[model samples]
Every structure is written in structure tokens, then in C-alpha cells.
Target: MMGGRGEGVGCVGGVGGRRVGVRGLGGVFEDKCKEGENEPYRGALAPALALALAPALANTHHHNIIKLSLQGNVGHLVQQHAICHGNLDYKLEDGQGPVLMTTVAMPVFSTKNETRNRGILLGVVGTDVPVSELLKTIPKYKLGIHGYAFAITNNGYILTHPDLRPLYGDGKKRRKPNYSSVDLSEVEWEDKDDTLRNAMVNRKTGTFSMEVKKSVDKGKRVLVLHNDYYYTDIKGTPFSLGVALSRGHGKFFFRGNVTVEEGLHDLEHPDVALADEWTYCNTDEHPEHRYLSQIEAIKLYLSGHEPHLQCDKELIQEVLFDAVVTAPLEAYWTSLVLNKSENSDKGVEIAYLGTRTGLSRINLFVVPDELTNQDFLTAEDKEGVFNADHFPLWYKRAAEQVPGTFVYSLPFNTGSENKSVVLASTAIQLLDERKSPIAAAVGIQMKLEFFQKKFWTASRQCAALDGKCSISCDDENINCYLIDNNGFVLVAEDYTLTGKFFGEAEGAVMSKLLQMGSFKRVTLYDYQALCWVFSESSDSGHTLLDPYFAFFSAVKWILTELVIFLVEFNLYSWWYSDLTAKGYNKGKRRKRMRKEDG
Candidate 1:
């Protein structure tokens, strides 16, 4: 029943509601705050407005947009409702007339993965605000104010204009008639009527002149003017706003009421040949935020799609911080290769690690600049950047010393500024049947100071040589090799075998000098290295070996040889029969039995 309500918009009415405060031109400087998760207040506010205006209302929303993604359709709906609701309460008749309201609706994809063919409707009803306030409400993009602004609908209806009335009002009997949502592109502005089309094409910020409908003089036909406008496509929601200010006053003045059909209509020079320089602008002089494109990127990213547009480095950083640190772990991360500048050579490498709880983690990956390549690094260049002495052993070491994290340390090297650094954090695994790692960790290039300060590193203290003993391992003798549980060598005497099981190491025989203590042999368990206890230690190359394991292996070898000997000698059946023969357990010898004997 909200259809064609603009037709009866002539009468004036007063409705007692909260007086809305216009932020004015200054509001254009304020940054937009992040909206609440997925929910648009206007979806509910519109109905409340309808109840106050038309008490017999059945619905506040003609269609629901909750099915749309939390980023796009939902966000735009919230923005429109906010802009309308915060303006004023408008009515048609004084004190007791039907309340005037502006309804906004757009089709948005249900979720990130769904296509546009399945877009859901997001709609909101708001009290109609005066045109004056609407014209002054420009978005703040960290750029200065635009020269002027205008509002339009999806079908190209002129919602609000600054210095003009209805494009073609019936008469002065109506100051402004409610066209509800009229197609202003059908009318003329500047020299022609192509403003809306051009605006849509310049989805971001561009300079274009449209045929001005409803000029201030109401009689100017060819009054063409140039302006710079910022376009905002309300993210996820289906709406756009064009805000701009005039670039120049004019080259000449024409009669305010004269319509220029073809030839010049200026009274001073009716047949004057005009040049395009007076109103030509190829590009924006001070390009800034293009709202429409930004919203598209937002919607695309939220709906599980990669945004095609080049992400702003600052914006990209902010988004990553929010997703990896601030947002709940349920909001998984997406990767981005951010370019610091369009002309810059190197790009930032980014990755994400998700978790069950949204607890923020610090750097989990630290690639020492000197050690991140095919070339070898000296001890000083490598430092604790890796665990081992050789480059390959570093790879064998885990990125983190512990199961869930890395040893975080901040290097004092001033030269780290030119180096590429990445911070990685643990992430939760995905629930797919593959049971593969859904997410391992989140990482970002070490550019932003915010990333650099949260850096993590691990360090260790050097132990004295008193408890250490020399042992020959794998023909490469080592003073002391780190060993693990079950008498397996870890940091083998031979550096090449660090990652392989210590039991597989060659020449790992115990040394006689190390046979002094009950637990002189050292090993590691749960990642901690320690000296293990032995029954006794002796000189002459005596090693502390677990006797039970030796016994178990010997038994296994004997059983294997016995089976082979019986099979090779063709006595397998005789051996089996003898072993299972009834007389064996009964303590009595049995005569050969025939198949017929039951």
C-alpha cells in the first residue's frame, strides 16, 4: 500500500518525533563506523516508522534482506535506513496527515557463494527527509568536500536536488510533487540528459555533465555545467550516491529561462559557436574514495569471492587486522598480495590462520633475510633464525619450537628495515573429511609497524662441556648429539641426520668415556633434551642400551629364522603337526593318523 504515495504529497502535516541533527558539511569528514554484524537496524526501524506514520501498518519491510551477506546488501540497507531515519520525520498534511516516507529496496546475493540470479531483496522504509538536508549530506572520504551532491534511485529517480524543484512540476501550486521515484534520466540536465547513465559508468569518481532537470530558472534548456562527484554504491545493499561540487562558475551568462535547443540561445550572441573547453574535464582533479567500487569489493570479498579490484594497501591492512585479530575465529581469513604503490616493485605477501576462539596470535613465521634462499648462510647471518648449523637442517626444524607456536623474538638489527618479514599465527583446522589442515597460520609482510612490534622469536642458552662427551655417529664424530626418547638420536653426531630417527643413525655406538654415570646418556622427550639413566656405564665403548628392547628383537629374529629353516627343508607340515599333535599337550606320543580316522 506504500505505492504512489508521492502522488498525494502536496499536503503538509506535523508529526511529533525526535528532531534529527544534520552533521552538515562537516559530517563529510567523519569516518564511517563499522556496522554491527549482519543485522540492519532499519529493517526494524522502518516498521517502527510505519507504525508511527500509518498505525494500521502490516509490515515495515516489503522484502527481507537478512538472507543477504553480512557485508553488502545488509550493510547498504542499514546505511540507507540510517541516512533517512536520522534526517527528520516528514508528513504530507499539517499535524494529522499521512506521514511521508522514502522506501529503499535492492536485490542482494543471499550469501558469498550464491550468484546474483539468486539475489535476495533487502528493503527499508524511512521518513522522507527534506531535499535541502539531503543535498548537504556528502560522504567523508578523507578528501575535502565535493562542490555539490545529488541523490538518485536504481531506476534513476532524482530523490533530492540542491537548487531545483521537480523536473517538470504541474505548476507553482506544488513546491515539489512526490514522484515517489521518477526516472530523472528521462529529463534534461546541462546540454543533454545523460547524467545517470554516465554516473553508473563511472562507478567510482568521474567528471561528467548530465542534462539538469528542473533547473533553478525552470526555463533553461541548454544549461550545461561541469562537476566532480564521488559515487558510492551502498555495499551489499543496492543503492548509489553521487556527491560533487562545481568546478568552475561559468564562461558566459545566459538568460535563466532560455532553453537552448540547437544553436546558441544566449541573448548576447544567439548564434555563437561554443567551444567545449568551458566545461570539459577528462578526469578527476582530486580523485579520492569511490564509494560504489569500494562497496562492490566489500560485497565480493564477504561473499567468499576474491575482489577483482586492486585493494588499497591501507584498507587491506585494516581488513586483515580485523579478520585475524579482532573478528571472531569463525570469520576465516582470505589471502592478498598487496601492492604498496602502483609503481613499487615488491609486494606484500599475506596469509591467514584461523582458530576456534578469536584469540589474536603474534608472529609465527620469521624468515631471516640472510637465510631465505638457495645460498648458504654463515653462523652470524643465521643466528636463531633457524635451529641447525646448516641451511637444510633449518628446513627440517619446525617453524615453531612448540606444537602451537613459534619462539617469538625481536632482533636488534637495524638493517631489518629493508628485509622482508612475515608474521604467522596458528589457525584452526578445517572440518572437511580430508582432515587436512584447514588453516595452519596467518602471515603478513613485515611492513606496518603494527605487524613488526608483535613479532616473536626464540632463543637458547649455551651449555658447558662438563656433562657432554664425544661420541662417533654415522662415521661423522660429534662431541654430543641431542637424542630423543626410546634411545633415538635427534641432533645426531652427524648434522645430516638431524631429522631422521636416531635409531637409524650409523656408528651410533656408545663411547667408553661416557660410561661413568647411571644416566650419563642424554636424550630428549616432549622436545626437551636431557641425560638418560642407565643400569651401569663402563669404559671401552660401553653404551647405555635398553636390554628389554634388545631381548624383544632377538626373539623376533629367532622366530623368523625358525620358520625359514622349516619351509626350506620341506618339514613345514611335519613341524606344524608335531606342534599341534594331541599327544604334545597330553604328554603322550600318538601314532600316525589316517584321514578316515575320526
Candidate 2:
């Protein structure tokens, strides 16, 4: 949460002394932007790339010049020059003409001394022979290459590179190697124990034991293979097989045991009970084991499917009847009027009920004629104030329409000094409602000047008898009596009153006056009541009556009393009945208590 220490009518300082202006009522949803404002431009990729890459290669020589500068260099110097040129000539043609090219060929080389003579002699001796004869010379000479090719041909096809085959042979001449005799059986065989007794034991078990063991091993191997295969299939790659196998064993042992035990337990005790006997069966091995006797009672009530208990039917019916009888009469009138006047022109239609203390009491202000069809309102027309001087007339009209509720407009203060006095007086009046007459008088005076200028400030200050006082904006310069909720006056000024009223008061009486300064928004009717009760009281001089009287008076004056009345009389019955219908009597009781406390 954020905290602050000053009170004013306009902007206030927030965290880090940032100013946040007070937003007026009804400004929460207003838009701040004007229509047709152009959005700012965002940069494109071409401009961004040009900006990033243009500077680095701004001044460099061509590759041809760099190459020519180091054409005949040697050692690291030549290598460095070649690298610095950084050029490749892949095109067949030069700058002006086709480039020359050359080719060099060498006879096939072999590492063995015996095979070296064959390659050289065969190629030299057959230089004059036709290409076909030259190719056939190696096989006719019973060359080792020819023998190798024959061996591969007689056995199976030789799986060597295609380019090396001319020195070997075509498929018809050479025998192929028998890769089937490569001894894969050694890789496949299983070892046996060396002890004779172990061998005899193995024989007695027969090929049956070996076969069973192999089958069991094969089964385990198949399981592992499937685990690996499916594991990689899901994950899209292979992981550690050992870790997977270990995890699989753990799951099997623990989960399988649990499953078996649960199955057996379920079979042995098929109709076990639950802990909450009211909601479920209670058949567990404990002292409370029994058939639920309340089941029939619950079913009987639930059968109707009405959200009320059998015992609460009367209360529910009574509530429905009360709602029908006590529904507000104004709501019905408003609805009927709205329906009939759907097409009526809108205008200020002030309704008044009666006159009291020379004031025409208002009931409602009807929609105005010109504003009904419009969507926008200027600052002067914002609060539907058509004429401030005739506000009492509007109140009188509204009063005529609604009988019980009082309606009136707050007086508009003007003329600098007088305005401050009026506002200070209003603030003092509000504080005075809490039964502190002297504080109210002082509070009004403290803020007289500022209020005159249409600026309001509230502050805490110390009072006599160790109490606190608050100086609110008001007309007079009174400062001694006003106090806030914390019993401190906000104005820092000398509080010695020299008036005849101050001289008549005793110390305790003055303390009571100081205590009264902490009130907020006291009404005339309540002040009259407090005066009737405390004006002649002695001893503590009405100080004891201040806090309690203020609290009760606030409850009566504010709409909060009506809200509490509605909750207690209407909402409580409805909620309790609802809970009772759902077979939750205890819940209903608790809900009633909670509603009362709240």
C-alpha cells in the first residue's frame, strides 16, 4: 500500500514526490486522446541494414592489384600476400581470353613390393597394345589382383569400390569371398561352467533347462528391446537404457505391490465407511462403525428438491410474503413513468413535495430537454447543473415526487474571503456533528483564509489536556478547539482563547470542547439531539457522551444503517433457509453468526 500525509483539493504528491492530480467523480472512463492523431513511423529493414554495414569496407583496393603485388614472393611472405589478396579464379576464361589448362596421370601405386612391379611392368609392356588388350593383360599373367578377383567371384561378389575394379576384374572371372564364414557363431555362443558337477547338473536339466533359461533370457531381452524401441520412438532419440530399466523395475515392484494389496483389501472389506458419517457411510474399523441412521431422514428432505429444509418451509413462505408486501413503492412508480414517457422530450423537470424551514425539499431532477439527445457535455453542464441559483427549486420539485427522502443542493460559496469562511464553516459543521461544538467552531476559523481562496487544508495539532485537534478549512480564525480522529489539532497556532465563551468554561469543559474537534460531518438534527442531552450536564461536562453519541449519530445519519437493516432482516433468512434445505443446519447456524458479526 502507498501512504501520504497532506490533504488538499487539487493535485497531491505521491511516491517520490510525483504529482498526481485528483480525478473528479465520473472521470474514470473518459478517454484522453483526440481523434485522427497520426501514429509515429517505424524504420524498415533496408535502411537499417544500410546503416549497419556501409562504413567498414569504404576504402579497399581491387583483388587484381593485390595479387600482382606479391606474385613472386617466397616463404611466409608469399603465403601472407596470397592470403591478403583473398581471391579465387573459378571461371574458365581470363579477363580477355580462354585460360590454358593441363592434366597429369600416374599408374596405380601399391604399398607391397611384389605388387609394385605388376603395375609398372604391365602398363609399360602394354603401351602399344589396344585399350581392350591392355586391360586384359593383368588377368592373363595370373596377377595377384586377378587371383583375388577370382577368389571373390568363386565365393561371392567383391564389395569394393567401382573405380578399383579394372585392376581386379569383371564379375565373371574372380570368385567372391564367403563372408558367411566370418565366424559370427563365436559372438552368439554362451559360456558354460567349468566344474564337472556343474556340467552334470546342466545335462540333467537337459536341453529343456537351457531352452527355458534361453527363453526367459530372451523374454527379458525382448522386454528391454521393446522399452528401448518405444522409448526412442516417443522421445525422438535414445537415452540411457540402464536408468530406464532401473526406473521400470522400481515402478513395477512398488506399484504392482500396492495394486495387489489394494485389490485384496477391497475384496475383504467391500463396504467400508467414510470419516464424515453424515455425508458418507461409516464402516471403517473404529468405535463409530454403524449404518447411517440419518440416510432416510436426508432422502426424505432431499426428495422434494426444494432448496429448503422441512423445518424451514414456514420461514421461507413468510419471507416471500414480506418481500411482496414491503418492496419499495418508488421503484414501481419509476418503472411505470419510464415506460410511458419513452418518447417524451428531456428537460429539467424539478419535483418538490413540501416546504420545511423555508427550504423547498427536492425529490428528483428529471432529464433535461436539450441534453437528452446529445452525447457530449461541457465543464459547466457536467454535473447536470442547469442553474445553481434555482437548485432549491429543483429540490422542491423532487421532494414533491418522493415523500420521505430529503433533497437539497449544497450552497455555492463565492467572494474570496466569504467563500473561505463558508467552506470553513461547512467543514466545522461536519466535524461538530460528532458532538464537539467548540472544536467545530475553531476548525471552521482555522481554514478561513485558504477556504476563501478555494484551497482547503487539514492538519493535526496538539491540544490542552494531552488530546489532539484538527483544523479544517472554515470561515473563522478559531484554532483552540478543533481536533481530528486522533485527538490532535492540525493547525500549529496559539490556542489561548480570550472570548467570553472561553472564560466561562472550566478546564474539564474546555477539554470536552477540544475532544469534540475530531468529528466529521455532523448534521443539525444530531447536534440538536446532543444539545438536548448534554447542555446542562455537570462533572465531566458531557465529554463521556461525545464518542458514543457520535458513533450512534453517524449510524443513524448515514445509509449504512439501512444496509445493515436489510442484511439482518432479509438476507439472513434467505441464506439460512438455503443452507437448511441443503441438509446443512450447522452451516446455516454458522452463517447466521458470521452475517451478524460482519
Query: Best TM-score goes to which candidate?
Result: 1
Where is model 1 more than 4 Å wrong at Cα? 1-90, 93-100, 105-136, 139-146, 167-178, 186-188, 191-198, 201-204, 209-230, 249-598
lDDT of 1: 0.30
- Give the per-residue lDDT digits (tens) of candidate 1, residues 167-266: 2333222323333433444332332446554554222323344322122111211122345333433322223345443333211111112122211111
Q: Please provide, for model 2 over 1-598, each residue's C-alpha lDDT reduced to its tens digit, 9 standing for 90 to 100.
A: 0111111110000112211121122221111111121122233221222222111111111122223333422222221211111110112334422211111111222335675445332210001111121121111111110011100111111111111112112223322132211111111112233221222111111110111011011011110011100000001000000001111111111001223233223222212111121121122223333332323323333346523333222222222222232223235435644764642432222222211111111212244442221311122222221111111222212222223322222122222222211111121111212221110011011122332123223232234535755543342664334322212222223222211122132446545645675222211110001111236545764754699887877877777778879879897788777553345579889999999999
Q: Which 10 consecutive positions of candidate 2 have the poorest summed lDDT?
A: 231-240
TM per prediction: 0.22, 0.12
As a whole number from 0 to 100, the lDDT of residue 490 in candidate 2 is: 21
